[model samples]
Target chain A: MSSALRIAAVAALLSLAAAPAAQAHRAWLLPGSTVLSGAEPWVTVDGAISNTLFYADHQPMRLDGLKAIGPDGTEVPLQNASTGKYRSTFDVKLAQPGTYKIVTATDMTMASYKIGGETKRWRGAAADVATAIPKDATDVQVSRNVRRIETFVTSGAPSTGALKPTGKGLELEPITHPNDLVASEKGRFRLLLDGKPAAGVEVEVVLGGVRYRAKGPELKIMTGGDGVFEVAWPEAGMYWIEAGVRGAPNGSAPAQNAAYIATVEVLPD
Target chain B: MRILKFSGLALAASGAAASPTVGQAADLTVSVEIPKLNVAEYHRPYVALWIEKPDQTAVRTLAVWYDTKLKANEGATWLKDMRTWWRRAGRSLNLPADGVSGPTKAPGRHVVSFSGGQLAGLAPGDYALSVEAAREVGGREVLRVPFSWPPRGAKTATATGSTELGAVSVTVKP
Candidate 1:
């Protein structure tokens, strides 16, 4: 091996020994309650990006442009992005006795890397191989990850139709209402791009900390000509559905990619 | 949680109770083939099979085979390896569930059937029949056969997994 190759091998060995334990990044949506008693009921939501079932040891995430969709079809602004020692908290008030949705989203993030003398910025599929950059050339690598979180709270008769796609970004519209999800019940959804079925989309569902691949119960599948897909909802809690689309490359560096995420809660019937 | 977990079975049982002699032929049949592979550690796999809606909701669980014979159901500890299935519906199910649960099968083809009571109240719609397998010290794989509900005449779909499992097929009466 050449001197550069030897150095790179040594660095790989060192990283294997010194790197932190591998953990998947997850956005948790913790709502105060799913069902309310009477009159106006408000839910306190604690949202954070972290590892494990619940804990905030990771970096705080900036949930850009937060809003709450009330049952009455009015969009209310959520308040407080309080960054805690381990997590962040936000609050939303449900003025009516129906299901309310609190959502926050971030844009697609791309990072530029300076390796050796060449500067390279890759997005979409190219980012998957960015690690191939040799240590000698690994001067600096920057990464920005896009993420979104959503939670549903209900006050009285659980409502639906509040989650329609807004004709923007990669989104999933559940034919099966979020509030009505239960075990042994059908959970259906359609992938939409600009209000229609989103064509040629890739999806990743994280369950029990394990992300679904091309097969399995939550089989990684692409929408057919109809832009509809289904997953076998095995167990229930908060399931993070990650969807991404890669548009045409803007000059061969990498295709401009966009991602959509929603954490839907399924209650025990 | 327990009530909702067993309601599927309960619904089936009630349907059977209502008409003892109806004896509806199983409308759907799931065929899963396990390939014998040359691996260092070759323990049988714990597999989970179910049907889901277009939204990917698990509408019904046909069967789950894991380390059920262990004294304390210790084999279940590894069920999480089935990843996608565990998160979608496995974790909530009580072990040793009467008709919907069983023990893991050796390398071969296995069939799990669903009848009238078992499939009580399933509405006609687009659905996917999914199967996943995870083994001890072995790899994991998942297969999905997307098919419509209440088969118009006879409908079937099949998919082959790359590892752990072989060909998986779903068949429903037309």
Candidate 2:
């Protein structure tokens, strides 16, 4: 199939998967901090598949395209990478603070071949334009569910200038400084659709890795009438705030589910 | 055995790291309840206890109970199941992390304290005491209780799990 045709096919498959009945799960890469101060400061990160965010114990699945970005904007590998029952765990030392981001991608693309009698999931960033449908292939389907998680870290006080959305999907453009968060502190965050405050979206903050609902401490509230949501910090440390909206299948635009996941850090004082 | 020395995470404190003298005298005690489930095969759950600042930076590790008797730290393979702590501070540490790593506890309430190096030089600020438990062929649960450094009066919080653990609690006394 041609590149343009493959792209069209993928869009069609994505729209089919966007039905309200389909499960819209999210994948996230959460870091302990976006900003690291003082001597020998380090941050640990957890990655998993859960639409609720920060709650790794819920449907914890491995994340694809996991990598750390150094202050210089380069891909850095994690040491002692391991997967447990809940999520994949790894740690990175913020030797130079700045804006270190932890990023991960989830494969939401679906490719179904009729002849195989088995549905094969395809990644949006993988080889889509090259492979041809195998012989006896009666039908082929493709869709997109790519999610991105971005966390930041700085040496001193965090800077809002550098912490902007990567324009990939839905994002939480935090009006509140993420690094200087305190336990039980009330914070304000704006849900951004295309660099604007998205309205009436649902947002949640999970205190720890929880597998069951109402098991651990978590706060779930819909974004206020506007796109901004007021979060009462449930007790700092590492927390994931996730919120998103469903972009209806528009003309030529597939039904896209944009999920915004941001790992925020709150300080002790 | 690394012999309970203050290094890496222990010695490395944040800018908030203050002299223990000025930080109110406080004590932290964490208790984990290992549930005894009547299953076909049962193995003790690996548990990790540690404290983190609002930034989720590990301040101190109270305990990491695993199969310490294995030859050449063989039990370390499954340590990652306790995802939160292993990612926050466990990997940087070698087993027999003296004062930290120990053998798994049977179904009972096990307690450990934050004192000596663990208590001293603790910066006064809001922090969370996180306790995580994961058992093989079972479920995983993580409990986090928010408290202040140099604890004032007495602060306590508890989290109960269905499979791997029962009621996990944390208490800090003035």
Candidate 3:
């Protein structure tokens, strides 16, 4: 073959080889182990970059513009803790008690990509009546008032059995408030038939193997009731989802129910 | 003051319940299609399928079809765009699923099936069957279909979404 013909053949081969590499950039956030956990809760967004064939001129694949938010709309900062990894921690010290959420976004290849996960919020209160220890004793004690103490338990479901009486034999009473109520993770859900407020509805919100149950209150409220139903979740992690509905067999609507679901992240205390 | 008290309550409340049923392996079929890339003529995409609750929680990982023939690394980078699946299930598992094929699917259409009993144990409720496709260099698209399993019935349902997939039909074969 002539020299000119050989040059032409080499050019063709080079173009063919680069064809696949020239295609559009495929970028997605890989948060390793998806399940974020800890006693003092936080999240580690770690994952590999797959098929990320970048242009020769551009930098190698890296997580750009990533952020996480807690359930109360607090921003969790992603710290550059190591190579090819990003992390964010939220302390409930300043975060409001409710379902927290984390939104992660990345700007790469001239486009911005985003996704998020939520964690259940369980903010318990220590309002029980306290009893003083011996004058020199360092132990502080409280009388367990059931109603007052119940307010701190996530979901306040009887199954939890986490509620306890104080040394003064004070029982913790359960109160109705939208403090930490996560919806049921079950697929199909229904509310009570009594047209009154949706109380006694069993809601089981499960993420991974963890389950949090929130039961509706017996208090009656209008269809568009403004009352809040809360349940305290056990763990502080990423993304908590609750699913359920309201209706009444005791009212005009029979077999009628509505479904409500929400996602949020629970920050650590 | 309120913060201090609430923290105490939060600690007591973290009781988690039992595991949701890992659906029994019921005979089922899943089809994934990829149109020939307008250019590179690259190999098929590596697709992943899993189940997510209507509430958007990862339930289980059903299948991940990728380019096993080449020993190519199925990078975890692009797994996030498989949004519905990632948040619901994928993020929970360790990498390189053993005993499963990982070769990318060729552009076109592919039909895959699983044995019966896979659908069992999925609590009777609403669920979204999700499938995601990732090309080595091309863009990624995920198609999800909504479905429900009644208390005692074996049936089939079909739904469609805009993405690399054409049509997805899920049948519960008892």
User: Model 1 chain B, poorest ten-residue lDDT window?
Assistant: B15-24
Q: Please, what are the lDDT tens digits per residue for candidate 1 over residues B35-142?
A: 998988789998999888877778877788887887655565566567667656765555566677788899999886676557656676888988988888887887
Per-residue lDDT of candidate 2, residues A1-269 (tens digit): 99999989998877676352234455566765554333335667777766564667555545446776765666666777778887888887755535566666453543455665754444443345226446566545444454556666654334454455666666766766665566656788877766666788888776645555466576787777567788777565666666656655454334566666676766433
Tens digit of per-residue lDDT, candidate 2, span B1-174: 132233324533431333343333467888788877899988889998888998888987778889988775667767755656765676556566666778999998888766445666567799888888888888788777788876668888887877677888888998
Go through the candidates in order and give each one's DockQ: 0.02, 0.03, 0.02
List the RMSD of every prediction in angstroms.
16.6, 13.5, 26.3
Candidate 3 CAPRI level: incorrect
In candidate 2, position B2 carries an lDDT of: 39
**lDDT (C-alpha) at residue A86 in model 3:** 27
Worst 10 residues of 2 chain B by lDDT: B1-10
Q: How does each model score on TM-score?
A: 0.47, 0.46, 0.34
Q: Encode model 3's per-residue lDDT on B1-174: one tens digit a residue.
A: 354344323432432222222333335566655665566556466677777887666566777775444333424444443544544455455545552336566666677665423343456678766787766566567776666654245666665645455566665543
Error of 2 at B169 (Å): 36
lDDT of 1 at B47: 91
What digit string (tens of lDDT, one per residue) describes model 3 on residues A6-122? 989987875564232222222222232222211122333332222321112232233343334444344545555343332222222212222223232221111011213221111
Cα-based lDDT at residue B18, candidate 3: 21
Give lDDT for model 3.
Answer: 0.39
Winner by TM-score: 1
Shift of residue A187 alpha carbon in model 3, Å? 25
- Candidate 2 segments exceeding 4 Å error: A1-35, A50-64, A70-77, A80-86, A106-108, A111-142, A209-216, A224-226, A251-253, A267-269, B1-174
Model 3 chain A: worst 10 consecutive residues (lDDT sum) = A148-157
